[model samples]
Target: MSKKKEALLAQYAGHITEKFSETPNMAFLDKVVTGLGPAIYNRDAALVSGSDESELETVKANFLIKKLGLEDGPHLMHAIKEVIREYGASERNKYRAVVYYILARRFNKEGIYK
Candidate 1:
């Protein structure tokens, strides 16, 4: 939430919008990335008030599930792993990559990466 970070996330959101145009819900994607960018940057506080990594992942996963309208199932878990695999190469923040891919998939059912 600093102005600099906001600017970065805004720029990033725009990049994603253009780069992943195949994805339909640009607005939602923008929101997700914008909201998550801060969380990812300040991951310690973003994940949770506490300092446990497991708790952090749990909180992040739950947030993604609710935000993306996904349910708890094998498919969801599979998709989460796939998101990590596909986007993890370039993205140092696995949580950000996971959230990005998941929301991208939701918005662009056909495939956003294409």
Candidate 2:
């Protein structure tokens, strides 16, 4: 991921944590942050140490799917992209959090998560 994207995901993680603070479960927040930034950074390390495409995919997918265990990954992925839009408004992560949280809440309520 680009540095720009890495920064975006960080803010997204903070936004997610803030918005979902009332929720009992924090699994998704943890899962996504694991899927990005350090995740890419870690992959770079693995590749430098000689990991292949299949090996890399296996590692990334396992973290994104199995660890996150979200029922709908594509939606979550999209929401992350949407959260990326907030990178421009770094000081306004709270705004982005509100927006994405609503997106997530709706996705859940509409059964999109299933």
Candidate 3:
């Protein structure tokens, strides 16, 4: 990984450990970050807005359904809401990598990254 990417990954891992209180699987997390490509470099794109309905919908439609190949249903939205809750409603900067990591783990879709 590039120095910048590596630094960002470390920063993300720190946030995950600090906020979520869980040590992330480095390999899987790396894959998630890599999969995100250039978006990670963009400040706005790197963060998930838990308060935005459309943002959450995009995560469900694009990431969960399309990327993970999950079926559309109420459960998907429920899962997204659940994740958002776990991520903390008061949390302003919800990193997309962390959110995607949690969602991927929730759906057992980590294998897709491999």
Candidate 4:
């Protein structure tokens, strides 16, 4: 990864730490994101590559409905959809999608959900 990619992921990792109050190493986070199961795991590469809106949306649903096993489950995944809707309305869909994408990856990496 380039220095810039490293910096972005680092900043994103910090955001996750603040939200969850758990410290996960940057390197570990990267590994897990890259190794994520397919479906919602478009982010494994998207994180450093490019932030595609369509891919991010699928990534979001995949993480929630697939990887995290939140499929149709309530709480977190539902809440994330709400944000996705807002981002769409505000025309920030791409950025917010990636943000949520990063959070989902972080959650999986830290094994956050019960």
Give the top-scoring candidate (lDDT): 3
TM-score of 2: 0.29
- Identify the runs in model 4 with alpha carbons over 4 angstroms from their true place: 32-60, 76-114
The global C-alpha lDDT for each of the candidates, from Candidate 1 onward, is 0.48, 0.40, 0.91, 0.48
- In model 4, which residue pairs have backbone atoms overlapping below 3 Å? none
Summed backbone clashes in each candidate are 0, 0, 0, 0
Those runs of model 1 whose alpha carbons end farther than 4 Å from true positions after fitting are 10-26, 34-61, 95-98, 107-114
For residues 1-114, what per-residue lDDT tens digits would candidate 1 score against the true structure? 477765645555544444444433445544555556546566653323223446545644665455554556666555545544544355443445334545455545423223
State the lDDT of candidate 3 residue by residue for 1-114, as single tens digits.
799999999988987787778898999999999999999999999999988999999999999998999999999989988877887877888899989998898899999997
Best by TM-score: 3
lDDT of 3: 0.91
* Candidate no. 4 TM-score: 0.41
The estimated TM-scores of all candidates read 0.50, 0.29, 0.93, 0.41
Give the Cα error of residue 19 in candidate 1, in Å: 9.1
Which runs in model 3 stand beyond 4 Å of their true positions? none
Q: lDDT, candidate 2, residue 16?
A: 52
